[model samples]
Target: MIHITRTLSIPDSEIQEQFIRASGPGGQNVNKVSSAVQLRFDVARSPSLPEAVRARLTVLAGRRINQEGILTIEAQRFRTQGRNRDDARVRLVELIRRATEVPELRRATKPTRASQRRRLESKQKHGDTKKQRRSVGPSDG
Candidate 1:
């Protein structure tokens, strides 16, 4: 079981991993060994996540989540399979932790009197500058 937090733990069965050939930093081992870890988590159908968490996870995942609702993460930074696998799990935990957080609601506020005055002052200043730049009339003293 992977513990995302004190309240949330995801079972190993929820995560599916595949080993594929990787193309970075392994020299000749890159050609011979399938060290890349392709981690798939079905956000839409996971029993571990609550409905709200699943929804947020899907949105957070963006392009990583496919049309079929599978979130795929490829970890191949390390040349060894064990490191790659651990990297993927860590990433998964981080993503889940992010999704678990509820964003603070925006408190609507009216413009302060001072702020409104400053804004109007700046606008008037800009208008005055533009007015001065315009060609003066011949009739003007």
Candidate 2:
């Protein structure tokens, strides 16, 4: 079981891993061996995740999560398949851990009276400065 938090844990059955060839430069070894790991987790169908966490996970995953609601994480930073697999799992855990955190609610606040007065005063002062810069016209008697 993979433990995300004290209250949340997901069994191995929920995760699926596929190994594919690692792209980019590495000579013959990279061409021959499949070192990259693609980790997939079903966010919509998972029983382990709570409804709120699932919603958050979907949003957080963004492009990573497909229409099927499968979150895919590709790990190819490491040359070895084992390291890549571990990296994929670590990333998945981190993502889920982030999804578990509830964002604090932001309370709507109005500007303080003093601040509002200062802002109006500042605007008036700026307008007066602009007004003083205007050239006196002959039509102004």
Candidate 3:
């Protein structure tokens, strides 16, 4: 079982892994051995995640989550398949850990009077600079 949070735990059965050739670094071994790990988890079907967590995970995953609601993570940092597999699992745990955290609600606050004054002051200064650069009228003489 993978523990996402105190309240949420995902079973091993839900995760699926696929092995494929890693694209970088390892020379002849890269061509011969499949070192990359592709970890797939179905966000829509996971019983472990709460509804709110699932919703946030979907948004966070962005393009990684397919239309079918599968979250795919690829790890190919290591030379050996075992290391790659471990890397993939670690990434999955980190992602779930992030998803499990509830974000603090932001309290809406209006701009302070001081801040407003400062903004206006800056604008006025900019306007005064521009005004000085303007061509003077013929009547100014």
Number of clashes recorded per candidate? 0, 0, 0
What is the per-residue lDDT of model 3 for residues 1-141, given as tens digits with 9 covering 90 to 100? 877667778898999999999998988999999989999999999887889889989988889899999999999999999999988888788877887788999999999999999999999999999999999899987
Which should have the higher TM-score, number 2 or number 3?
Answer: 2
Q: What is the C-alpha lDDT profile of model 1 across 1-141, one tens digit per residue?
A: 999989999999999999999986778999999999999998888999998889999999999999999999999999899999999999999999999999999999999999999999999999999999999789985
Cα deviation of 98 in candidate 2 (Å)? 1.1
Every candidate's CA RMSD: 2.1, 2.1, 2.2
Decide which is better by lDDT, 1 or 3: 1
By summed lDDT, which 10 consecutive residues of candidate 3 come out lowest?
1-10
User: Which stretches of model 3 miss by more than 4 angstroms?
Assistant: 133-139
List the candidates' TM-scores in order: 0.87, 0.87, 0.83
Report the alpha-carbon TM-score of model 1 versus the true structure. Answer: 0.87
Weakest ten-residue segment in model 1 by summed lDDT: 23-32
lDDT for model 3: 0.90
RMSD of 1: 2.1
User: What tens digits encode model 2's per-residue C-alpha lDDT throughout 1-141?
Assistant: 999999999999999999999998788989899999999999999999999999999999999999999999999999899999999999999999999999999999999999999999999999999999999999987
Model 2, runs deviating above 4 Å: 128-141
**Over all chains combined, what TM-score does candidate 3 have?**
0.83
